[model samples]
Target: MKNLRLERCGITQYDEIFYNLSYDELFRHETDAALPDSERGVVASSGAVAVDTGKFTGRSPKDKYVVNEETSRDKIWWGIGPVAPTTNNSDNQQISEETWYYLKDLCLKRLNGRKLYVVDGFCGTNEDSRMRIRLVTEIAWKAHFFKNMFIRPTAKELEGFVPDWTILDACKITCPEPQRHNLRTPVFVAFNMMERMTLIGGTWYGGEIKKGIFSVMNYFLPLKGMGSFHCSANMGRDGDTALFFGLSGTGKTTLSTDPKRLLIGDDEHGWDHDGIFNLEGGCYAKCIKLSPEKEPDIFKAIRRNALLENVVMDAKGVVDYSCDKKTENTRASYPIDHIERIVRPVSRGGHPSRIIFLTCDAYGVLPPVAKLTQDQAMYHFLSGYTAKVAGTELGITEPKATFSTCFGQAFLFLHPTRYANILGRKMEEHGSQAYLVNTGWIRGKYGEGERMDLASTRRIIDAILDGTLDEASFETMPIFNLQVPREIPGVDSGILNPRNVWKDKADYDKTCRKLAGMFMAHFNNFTDTEKGRALVAAGPQLDAEADAAYSSEA
Candidate 1:
């Protein structure tokens, strides 16, 4: 075997950096050498290695930034407005070139005289469109994490593979000059599109590393005439493919990993002229309350090579997937091959026949499932509506409504309407069908209403895939203009219409009107263009009486 070293890449500053260590080597170093005593490993019941992220569990969205430079300045979307920011930051502020170089120098300086780990990998599964990536980290576990999260190259492919993008993660290096760098805190995650490099410092959370790469793919894929998505995809026995779009806690991973279907990829994907391709080589599943019975594939994937993040464990090395003492975003990263029933090729699949937009509507106004018109589909695709439940993040004590355009507002590089336009064109050209499924509450608000049963949701999805739901009688929702089915197998006909299930008819009407108003308010951000106008016109409509009633109630 050939030796791995940074010298191969012409980096003379670091002489002791270990390049492209195997999984076994990474695991050994992680457990026995790289980590501190407090960050030591624990063996899970299934034999996987588990470790806590400490203090910062979930992603720090606020800390993420894109450097403002001439190379990609005009093409980039800047600042959050009536429309949500593409970066998902409240102040999508762009730092100066001096600030970016300063941070980069600081990160590189921190790695001096320190042992580093590097992993060479690919981002896109489509061989023709994939970008080579080099991940350099200060911790052994991060190298292991990248090894599991990214597509691994075979020995032949690794012989002379030069990276197109490089990510330098010096997680322990805090920026003391936060004020000068225009950072909110001592931590920073910044990406330079022109340079094709990502810098991470002051935080050891694993998600920063994953999402940093995702942001880069989001920027470049669209420019290449491909649509990058934050969704899970799968193909059926008959080669029928489906895509599930949702934010975290919306069951994108769980719903797409069907026992009957073959998993293509979870989390990130790209759609191009040929078909849909997995942007990642593995699954980073949320492990909160995980169970063998509920998700056997993901549960079993938690084995020797899987990397557990922020999960709570007992002194005896038994993992408590149900424990949230750390955070609700506990996660596990494993290669797609870990799942026994995944699709062959595992990187790319046929163009999707169906696209499902998932939302956990806390207001309980949307029906369980609704067929969308082409215009309505574009509208909802741009809206990307969902509710954030409590415990998913700090300071969120109840379900809060959120609108992330294209279902991934945080990682977008261009305006969301641009992505929506591409999706609309593709769906129209391919003659694909779209549906809206609410994996959320019904009949009442969050605290009062019962969550939509997982079994019922699954049955609904099965019906859609099998072409049964299309045969059912459909009724038009009053405000949203959504086509709601009157019946579905394994689901009560009453629950098909959210209003029918509500005990208080007046309350349901009021809640529905309020939600409609909220939708209108959010859509106002994109009403400047002709396409935007059409989309706004396709959304829910409020009558005079309902508007009056809602106003009086407010």
Candidate 2:
């Protein structure tokens, strides 16, 4: 039976394979191997294992490919239809079946004579919607990472386990002569949906392993009339659920891992008729400059069975979370059980009562907290805007505007409007309210303005969760038409309206108008259906209001 399963996984030949080893067994194997070579990584003082990703510290989007076969040819969004191009347009690049077979054969040849590590796991927490997955790797630490990131099957549950999908991870090998092979680079991540398999090579970055499956779920779930989101979710004490949607560095993981609430999941989730379910069993949190004072839960959770990637450490195994010597994208991956406050036994929640769209607006023009009309919510959902600060990347000296459709464009399989439409129906069906919270600057743009204090952002979130801001007085902000509350209990009212804190009101208007115009231009990429048109129409009016204000001043 085991050989048959291996044959089914296209593993007809191998020197040896270790299947479904316990956590301690895998950890022992990994550490024993690493003892001789510290470069492979060592156990940190905190009991977490730290390793470095070679060649790349992040995902390679251009090298990611989707097979243009019968299963997903017409379904996948090939490109943004006829608008100004953006970075996200590189998503869902197509590859031929011939190319997939060539790469698959190369990877399997490399794995044939080697000792292999295989792990069996599940992705979705919802029993009905979950996908069974089998991951085969050449390294034990990556097997440990797969175990940490996915829902671990019980001893009895593994009795007759067969995977719904299989991933062959050949992380060390690279494709040769890319031009002849129809590849963007030597490093490639190709998903063949028809075969229910993914092949990864030439990069040791662990994110590619998890996100490869996430991209699959983003394709399959929506076809079943369910919603797959790249956002974080948590539940209040009273069973009220909330979701925080944002791209990286915009505080999605930071805000959702609330000490006061029970964390459902920190990264990806699914919404269906049965409510919300976590797509993974773990949290992958950014740890650059991480401190207990700011993020006590994440700080404390990074011990005993957690895995750290690309973090700097000393000879004594002391990790400096502040050091970016390796990369600013240093990360910690740990199971949800590591958290003190979490929904036990299950990582599921009821339908959301509120959805907060967090944006790090570097221009300092957006209000700290604003209630969003459903149309406005849909607009922002499709826009999915955030800002990348200076020093985060090379050549980014000032705040650079970044946008991802649904805040996860890189992982989406269908057109972005598909998910937006599903979210709209679900929110309306459940009567969920929406809010836009700016966690960026307050007084002026970037260098001139001060970043909003973490305490202030937390207080603003508390007001929303406690239902205190629902009945507060609100006024419409110009240019964007967002309804901003005049006051909150613990937050300074002076910063509530971003325009009020600015030293120069004219500069604020100019910056705000510039941002509004950027929104209008970027949103033009969508191929609008009637519903999409409504969402687009609900966005900021680039000229009418701002033009009227200028004329009135004249």
The backbone clash count of each candidate, in order, is: 1, 0
lDDT of 1 at 12: 47
Q: How much RMSD separates candidate 2 from the native structure?
A: 2.5
TM-score of structure candidate 2 = 0.95
Per-residue CA lDDT of candidate 1, range 1-554, in tens?
35555543334476467778887787778888445864566667777878777767877777777788999998777764322333333234577889888988888787766777888999988887888999887788888889888889998899988888888888878899787666777888888888888888888888887887888888888888888888889999898889999877677888888988988888899999888999988889888999999889988899989989888777777788899887888899998899998878656788888999999998888999999888898899888899866674576545667988788877877877778888888898887799999999987878779899899999999998888887789987777878999999888889898987788877888778888887888887677667788788789888875456445543
Error of 2 at 450 (Å): 1.3
RMSD of each: 3.4, 2.5
- The candidate that wins on lDDT is 2
Clashing pairs in 2: none
Per-residue lDDT of candidate 2, residues 1-554 (tens digit): 26427777578788888887887887787788534452355789999988888778999877888888997888888753212233445477777899899899888988877888899999999999899999998888889889999999997878878899999999878999777776778889999889999999998888998998999999999999999999889999999999999987777777887878998988899999978999998888889999998889989999978999999988999999899988999989898899888887999999999999999999998898999988888889988998867685575557778878888988988988899888988999999889999999989989899999988999999999888988899988877988999999999999998988899888888888888988888787674456776677678886676667644643
Candidate with maximal TM-score: 2
Candidate 1 yields a Cα-based lDDT of: 0.82
Residue 176 lDDT in model 2? 93
